[model samples]
Target chain A: DTAVSQTPKYLVTQMGNDKSIKCEQNLGHDTMYWYKQDSKKFLKIMFSYNNKELIINETVPNRFSPKSPDKAHLNLHINSLELGDSAVYFCASSQEASGRTDTQYFGPGTRLTVL
Target chain B: AQSVAQPEDQVNVAEGNPLTVKCTYSVSGNPYLFWYVQYPNRGLQFLLKYITGDNLVKGSYGFEAEFNKSQTSFHLKKPSALVSDSALYFCAAKTGANNLFFGTGTRLTVIP
Candidate 1:
């Protein structure tokens, strides 16, 4: 079974359009995270949620918002997408809030392209 | 603040030869270091981690990492590399606040 999964493997939209990417995990983990990989292959954390509670919010723009309906799901919504938003977004989950010793499993990743 | 660094942008090795990918880190307190590998068009995959125990930790696909406190380094190593092992490797360190900081990444090319 796929431990972590993401929907809309590829999203291509025009500028000013809105889009959303869905993420889910069946590893029975408590914490989920959203990460963005830019053109340079730099991976940065965008948001983190623990038990449906927002925990970490990086200095990302307000145009990007993450919502967690439950512990197993965390979705990212982009408002008025721009060309800069084109990149691969990854979903990950870990077993503990400490995250120090836990292994975070990642999904296949969703490639977002804003033209 | 916590951060991880991968000095080498790329490392090339021949099949059946040993390989090493260097990684260094800095944090306020004890660090929880991890190694992840990514293939083309795929997400990152967990390889191994070091919390607190033996300095050497082993993980999937014959990959292992050594954690050195004094040097503040966690380097990934393989005794014999396979052509299939060619991929991008990432090193990360976790802070007290549970934030994970990732290095830029090192591309490993195992030539046949």
Candidate 2:
């Protein structure tokens, strides 16, 4: 079974459109995170949720929002997508909190294209 | 604040040869350093991590990383290169906070 899985492996949409990416993990990890990999291949943390509580919110645009209904799922919703939003988004989860020793498991990633 | 740096943008190696991907970091307090690999069109796969106790840590696919506290460096190395090993490698650090910082990433190309 896949540890972490995201739906819609590929997404293509036009500007001003809204989209949502779904993620789920079976590893029983407490913290789930969303990362954006831009065209330059730089992965930056967007949001992190631990047990449905918002932990970290980086300097991301308001168009992006994350919702975790439960510990096993974290979904990303992007509103009014822009051309610059074309990139790959990944979902990851880790076991613990407050430290760096926790190893994160990542999903297959969803490639988003704003045309 | 925690940060990671990947000095090389790309590393090319021939199959059966050894390869190294350099990574360094800056963080407050002890660091939990990690190496991850990403194949094209895929997300990242955790390779190995250093959480103290020892200087070297080994992970899947025969990849290993050495963590140096004085130099604040964690480099990924492998004894033999394979075409399948060609992928993007990322180095990251976890500070005292829950957030993890990632380097830009180094692209590895293993020629057969």
Q: What's the lDDT for all of these models?
A: 0.91, 0.92
Model 1: residue A67 alpha-carbon error in angstroms: 1.4
Ten-residue stretch with the least lDDT total in model 2 chain B: B92-101
- Write the residue-wise lDDT of candidate 1 on A3-100 in tens digits: 99999999999999988999999998999899999988899998888964676565899999988888889999999999999999999999976656
Which tens-of-lDDT digit does each residue in B53-83 have in candidate 2? 8898999999999988889899999999999
Candidate 1 chain A lDDT trough over 10 residues, lowest sum: A49-58
Q: Model 2: what TM-score for its first chain?
A: 0.94
> Residue-wise lDDT of candidate 1 within B47-107, one digit each (tens)?
9988889999999999999999999999999999999999999999886657687999999
Error of 2 at A91 (Å): 0.4
